[model samples]
Target: MKLPKELVNGSIIFIGITAYFLLMVILGYGNSFYLRLVNIFFVFYGVNRTIQMNVKEGQTDFVSNAVSTMVTSLIGVFLSIIGLVIYSYMQGGDDYVQSLSETFLFGGNPSIFIYSVSLLFEGIASSVIVTMLLMLYWNNRLTAD
Candidate 1:
């Protein structure tokens, strides 16, 4: 039952995402499941990377994991936002945000730049949060390994 480092991380990410996706669905956030899944992948990857940190031999490198996760999450969130915005614009600018599902799609204002920035911030924050949780798990397992 031994798993390589990469497999372990990947498995963790896959399981985590599945759990989150199911939760979102159960909680009624699954209307745009496709979009949410795409966005969540980035967070999953980033969090998985964070969980890769190993300090088993009196070693510590939590900061590196934190940074990587932050960066990855940011990228994921940004990509998701971009997809949403493009979809929104295509559906018809002012007329698009009418639906409840579309309302949750996130198009802050008329400016693309502002929307981009907002998504970027969401990415960064999400990545940081996901990574932080992974880091805690990693740290705890470090000594047990």
Candidate 2:
């Protein structure tokens, strides 16, 4: 039974982000520079895998690659957000929420308004940046005359 291409790519993104987050949690690296580095690495890894999957499926056009990367990145970001929420709730949601607000926002309280807006913008920007960077890499590597 062959999985759909989108499903495969989405799984890659979700798994990559989840793995990174889990590692961070296990290592107690939350809100650290190492966590940021790992996040960047996992995001690019997902984009790379998505591009590779596109090539494997013979959908290697620039648009296809870019779209796959963007879709996969978005899915990963969505899953990561969900995972974070779940983790926070599991680890006493109130304190987790306060920590996030203090860490990211102005250190007051967990304002759902600010958190949601920030995540939305950050996810969109991250998808665009990752897609562009991966497309550039693939174009230069795969389409050179």
Candidate 3:
């Protein structure tokens, strides 16, 4: 059975993010700025591909396109977060958890549950933002005839 275009696009995004993370680990720069910056490109690529796939599949309605973009972003974010959690556990969870707490949740250490919840919210926000930006571009293209 063929996968839906949305799933295909999401998988692409997830794979790209996971590959980047692995690359960072290999290069011993897992938490570096440069590697993180590369993730922006992955997001853009995912959104672009989502648009292309939706159009190709004759699902060019704005809502359909937007849904596809959102789905793609969600999958990317979910996979990225899961990968990070695994990396943290592998590298020893305490230091990783403490760093995250200091960096994001102020000083006091947060439980893993809290940290994961925060990550989920961040992912949702990312999904919405990417979807909105892509939809704006796509809308213009659609109207530019």
**Leading candidate by lDDT:** 3
Runs in model 1 with CA error above 4 Å?
1-42, 49-60, 100-122
Sort by lDDT, top down from the best: 3, 2, 1
Count of backbone collisions in candidate 3: 0
Model 3 residue runs over 4 Å out of place are 100-106
**Against the unseen true structure, what C-alpha lDDT does each candidate score?**
0.56, 0.73, 0.77
Residue 62's lDDT within candidate 1 is 69
Q: What is the C-alpha RMSD of each candidate to the true structure, in Å?
A: 7.1, 2.3, 2.3
Q: Compare the candidates by TM-score and give the number of the best one.
A: 3
Among residues 3 or more apart in sequence or in different chains, the pairs in candidate 1 whose N, CA or C atoms overlap within 3 Å are: none
By TM-score, the candidates rank as: 3, 2, 1
Model 1 TM: 0.53
Candidate 2 Cα errors over 4 Å, as ranges: none
- Model 1: which ten-residue window has the lowest total lDDT? 50-59
Q: How high is the lDDT of residue 112 in model 3?
A: 59
Which lDDT tens digits does candidate 3 get at residues 14-62? 7888887788769888646455667767887887898987777777799
TM-score of each: 0.53, 0.81, 0.84
